[model samples]
Target: MPVIDFVTDEENLTMTVTAEFAAPVERVWAAYSDPRQLERFWGPPGWPATFTTWEHTPGGKAQYTMSGPRGEKSTGTWEFLAIDAPHRFEVLDAFANEDGTPMEGFPSMRMTFEFTPAGDSTRMSSTTYFDSLEALEQTVAMGAIEGTKMAMAQIDAVLQDLRDYAQGKGTRVELLDDTHVRITRLIDGPRDLVWRAHHDPDLVRQWMLGPDGWEMTECIAATEVGQSYRNSWAPVGDTPGEPFGFEGEVLLFDAPRRAVTTERMQGMPVETLNDLNLYEEDGATLVTVLIEYPDKETRDMILATGMADGMEASYARLESAVLTPER
Candidate 1:
């Protein structure tokens, strides 16, 4: 877990805060660009921010307000100075009246948000420039650094969810035994969303797509124990191969937590027992999927088919398609 780093250099009249997230560069940029996503974490832990008007264009304006736990309110406005997709943005931040009008004679701070690729993650660097050392010192003395750190800390969960939605490799595989395997993923979302993603047919079709150009055509699922469910997949276009489908029976069902299911492919010989477990940590979800094979040969055969890789892709699609919507 990476924390936000704050640097203040009053001599240069500049301040900076940087944080890293386990997500792609584009997703990080989206959080800042989208008003709804921005409202989710723009303020410190105690103060909640809401965006009333946001326009992501040069020369445009964004207006938001932060309300304290005891109902105190502070409004701020941003005048966009520059815009670059998925890389950087610059804005002039100013104190504003309740109606979003900038207060006269109040000094404004210019800030730039930068997103850079760090391996599979993104490093976000925000630099705020002040007109004078006095302004910088005044802002710092007003708990700017600590407040910024607190606000930046909220990006991790948001970025993780965005990453999972953008690229489906969030799931990891672990061999439990010769006849059993476990798949786990750190879902940067609530347990309920994850549960709905699995049980809801509309959401299931978003990420349960199989192979390239193949989409889930039919998904009928019921999580009640002993209930039968079926899913089918077909090519998006008229390509080679006929459509295939499978049916499964739920052995155990626990809403938003765990489930046990038995499944067999249309022409497969053995029935695979799958145990799905979801645990909540803070605001994130830990998903563990245990598959119990009847024998080592069956497990090996399934693994050889690149089962794990396919699931990763599917889950990624699920996150990006079902979890992250265009703002």
Candidate 2:
């Protein structure tokens, strides 16, 4: 893959960047072409931009303000140089004052993006040509590299979210063998009640714990497939404890029914898939769980760690909550 790369010339005072994404060319193009979607994941993480105008065509103009933390803001404009759907786009980028005036002492540059097909992913190369090496060096010194890294990371996250939203209906986890420890439990409750047990953070904390004094520190339910949530668990007994633990993402979120899933880490690792199915039968709900790990070692470890016990307990808590009288 033609991953993101930044090249600077000391003698000429110029810089260029190239990066790729694991998506189709068309899919990648939609992100850049759609102003609303672009704003959703644009700029660095936590610093989103507001698009004033976007004319996505050759010779058209795009204006936006990039806002930083503490209300710091910089407006900019891009004059489209070329446009080829799902393939190529070129534009001029410049720094400007918040009032839309071009900033003095800031050099404008040309940005060219080329999208190429690489199997199931799109190799996107974005190159920015500065006027001189001084400009490139000065920009780099101003934290351009770190900012770009954050921006690309945001893009990756947004793309993954988009993919998850598109494939929200089906389950991502597949069952491999019967020895993988699959279980199905039927609860005598309405679908809404069962759904509430999984969707509510407080309810989730009640059931998802080990036999000892483990407690959930943080929990968030996205209520959508491919959306992510984090649950932190800590030991509270008289024994020693792990510093921080417990993390997972929503792989499948079928409201009133089931969820499929995986664990999210800071960086990439071997993929693990989990499938949860919910169905209503005779005024009650039945939940089926299927977990798939990369290898036997992981599967064995999960089983030995009392995962099923915790799950059963969590469901029991859910049952109690459903059966409890309304106050």
Candidate 3:
């Protein structure tokens, strides 16, 4: 087994990183040359990435979007300089605007990837060259090297796991926009358990509030799509407060699947979206909740308000309710 290593030369504005994989040269080559296979394990951990466009020929390009952490969308074009099938490939990479137009302030860099067969395994090396030392310094400050290494490690792990399973990984969650709160885990429990925890009036009273004495005064769930639901909450601390609330229509509801969609319409009145998807995995059910916002600004605001932390707490409470044995 070969270890991963990084060599940087700030004066030359260049960095070279190398790693060895236990897999055959063919396997590692396919992972890089094929876009479809690349998407399965291309991103860093905790973020989902989608490859929008990819062409392997010289002067061809590739674009992708990565979300999670902070919902940043980036695009880049690749000009293939050399292509030696299953051996080596080189290209020029640059940042582009969302509309696919080249942007200022970003350095166009040359990236070359070489794959050499070392016995039954493969030795992989990547060399990145910048236009100038100033550009390199700026990229270093942006943590480009560290971020790239992290992403590559994730790809390696994902590839090894897929080989072990003899199958690919499952679909991932993509960040729609920038938001303050990160939804860490989407768990699935029994339909009755989920419904009782989210819809039952009594269950709502306990875990939805915080330490400052908050209460859910009203929670209404309508079965129909166009029908609406409203939740009104108020603080009950030493300082009396007015109600803070949200109201939205039921976009979807399927009891068997235990899925629901709610749109927020009051208090903050911001358009907050929530989706719940439930299905069976193994012997137990899994539930995935997706939340989207219009942009990154509001997402940051929600994060600053401790909403993400509050959400994790709420999920923990739900877990407790299901895991506790029934009398």
Candidate 4:
């Protein structure tokens, strides 16, 4: 097991767990920074985690659900309070309802995670501070300590399998639920540039074209909440396919980190929520988009249209035509 010390102090109303990993600090940090790596081991052995939302910066929030063996499920949320990259971070951890609101009767805790270099390895100390002794006792009674140990035990493998989790995999998609899908692509550029590429009309027109023989005819990007944005595409010359377009109104906009929009095909009533998040680690940015469709049929129809392959083509073009040239 990676956990070497598990201590619960009722006097201080705190529980601290210390674990050692056979990897460098950067590698260990990446395991937690990337939601894909985190979901693999965040839950105990039987309950696997699925992070629906991940915003790693300070003042951001992350939401995840853990599915149990017997169809049971638990939801949780983390509100980031502080972040010191590759070293320490703090979050307000709490039980959450299905809609992501804090669950009543469950106490929230201030959890701090610190990573330090130890010889050829890294030492991670996680400390959870409760508001009251009753709160600490309540959480401990709910298998928090044992569950945490089991969860940390699974991280060693994630830290070791670096290639499987990182870039060179191209754009990938995950079915989060019947109506929700997640798409991820790791871009070889900084987060700021990648965010700008999605918003700047000139940069967007250069890479957002999905495939060869296609051209972006209109590029109107929304810069603030409630503003509408439209993008249209047309085949070049005699290339097959009709002109298509999408229009959306921005619901939330956090530059260089996240954006949420309501998207729909032109003149179509069916709409989907598109959530875009960007995270930078080790000079590269990971782009994650969570799309919520109207229903299963719509989700399947979109996937059947080779959405992932088209996204891969656009991301490839982005690297070649925009990022590479800038570098």
Candidate 5:
């Protein structure tokens, strides 16, 4: 975890969070300045944020919505007060409605975020100034301290370069929270080819086989939002496993960049949201899949079935069987 200290002072009407990262100050600052990167960790676990409007200059404003696990959403806005490059920035943060109007009876906080060098690493201190003691206590009672800590804990990954973070890591699973997990794999192919391999039936059939003894018996790729996709696999002769399949509807489809789908096993009622993102640098693509389960029990049950190992095998096959020939 990145957060080192969280302090709340009622007399001063302040809440401060201190965190340290293994990255430089500039890299850490970039994560906050970029809307795409900031959205990845701005909210607590299981409640990912989407920034709709971001103007990084002083006197500009940003609007965002944090979507909860069960279709709930909370909107917020930030008015940039100051920007000092890779050193510090200040903003007025407040709760807002869907149309960016500030909510009534809620006090806004003047937040100052400072980044400094801590030896080879970077140290960040965020102090929130409330208008009154009641406002400070109210925010703390609403879980501000713990929520900020959880949110900052996710920043380390964002500060890392894709190649440095996922290369040679195989398919690794990170438990983000009770019901959320992130999986990453570095593929030796361009972003377009990697995305095509996921959506093209012919390419998927060539590499999606989980193991040597298995074969993809059926594949129906979904190419657009609201479309449904299905895939089934079965073991070859003398193989040990039984036939199984999964089906899902595509919620988001941004070709060659990102995709989001609702996945569930065939004949099962439970569902999980799978958010897939692809980033490429120098002919290599990093694949990130963030999955949100219905509950902790369901999350553990699914991961216990050796999912990461199977994904690693399939990714290796994708590189050799699908990408190598095209290179």
Candidate 6:
């Protein structure tokens, strides 16, 4: 695991964020150099950034907009001052008008991103210098520190995906609609093995545990159209509370290809339909879990639980627990 730390030097008119990634320098470099990959992590969780113009050369102009949950848009631009591949990039980053012009009242920032190799990992330090102490304080008050930290954590998952793809195990999660969310992963085995990993109580207990220090105390999957599955988890050590549990009735089951369930979480008032879609691609199992809530508010609330990130973490572990074993 990696941690992002923020530091401010008021006298120098700069704010710095430092974090070390588990990946090598090249993978970290590719994350920022590639526009597509950059878009994935340039913004925080609720807001997504789309880059319209990306030119890496010196003095090149890069334009992008980050869209809010309500479809509101915030535009920005990066004027490249320098670009040193796999090591550093310097730019004038600023909020901009819709047409790409720098906004009149906002201050532009001189930003520098430096990456260094540290024993098979990469150390990243990003510094942003503003014109005055007031400008720096203003940006910090505008959620810059927290947003950047969140974005960095997101890049962690992106890096893991890159590593997984190289090993024939990778997963992707995206918002499908207000009520539907989709998570897809490439499992390194046939459909049946993947199915057993999910449906077998013993294997399910092994891979589906929630967070650290929590273990599934019980697991049961009937695997029939009308039958139900249940799981209960509790703290591993001397924890005080009772175990939490959830159950779902199978809505559809097609052997090793697909299954659907209307799952009800404990203490929740709503039931969400989870469609488990599986298919074979390139001698691997492509698994997609589509969960649909009753409304946008409900779905958004669930997402705020950091469920997406947890799913990624679990799938990362699954590569070793089940996928790799069947490989």
- lDDT at position 159, candidate 6: 75
Pairing residues by index, what is the TM-score of model 6? 0.56
| Clashing residue pairs, backbone N/CA/C < 3 A, model 6 | none
Question: Which order, best to worst by TM-score?
Answer: 5, 4, 6, 3, 2, 1
Residue 129 of candidate 5: its Cα lDDT?
97
Give me the candidate number with maximum TM-score: 5
Q: Residue-wise lDDT of candidate 3 within 73-174, one digit each (tens)?
A: 566666788888888999887777877677799988999999888897789999899989888888788777665665665454334543232212222333
Poorly placed runs, candidate 4 (over 4 Å):
1-164
- Score residue 114 of candidate 6 by CA lDDT: 96
Kindly report which residue stretches of model 5 are placed more than 4 angstroms away from their true locations once superposed: 43-55, 64-75, 97-99, 132-147
Better of 1 and 2 by lDDT: 1
* Model 1 C-alpha RMSD to native: 15.5
> What lDDT, from 0 to 1, does candidate 4 have?
0.87
TM-score between candidate 2 and the true structure: 0.52
lDDT by residue (tens digit), candidate 2, 83-187: 988799999998887666779999898988888897998887777787877778778988887667656654653465533432222212212343244455656
Give the whole-model CA lDDT for all candidates, comma-separated.
0.78, 0.66, 0.63, 0.87, 0.89, 0.78
- Candidate 4 backbone collisions, by pair: none
| Cα lDDT of model 1 by residue, 20-118, tens digit | 888889888888899877876798654558899888899999999986533468899999999999899999999999988887756699999899999
Quote each prediction's TM-score: 0.51, 0.52, 0.53, 0.59, 0.86, 0.56
Give Cα distance to truth, residue 141, candidate 4, Å.
19
Encode model 6's per-residue lDDT on 1-327: one tens digit a residue: 254678999989989999999899999999898887898779765455889999999999999998653345899999999999989999999999999998987889999999999998999999999899889989999999877876666576567653344344445666755776767776667777788888888778778875667788879887887897888888878855567888878867767866777788877668888878665645666676877789999888888877766566666666678778767
Model 5, range 77-174, lDDT digits (tens) per residue? Answer: 99999999999999999999999999998889999999999999999999999999999989988888778877887776678876777778799888
Off by over 4 Å in 2: 1-4, 11-13, 161-327
Q: What stretches of model 6 exceed 4 Å from their correct place?
A: 162-327
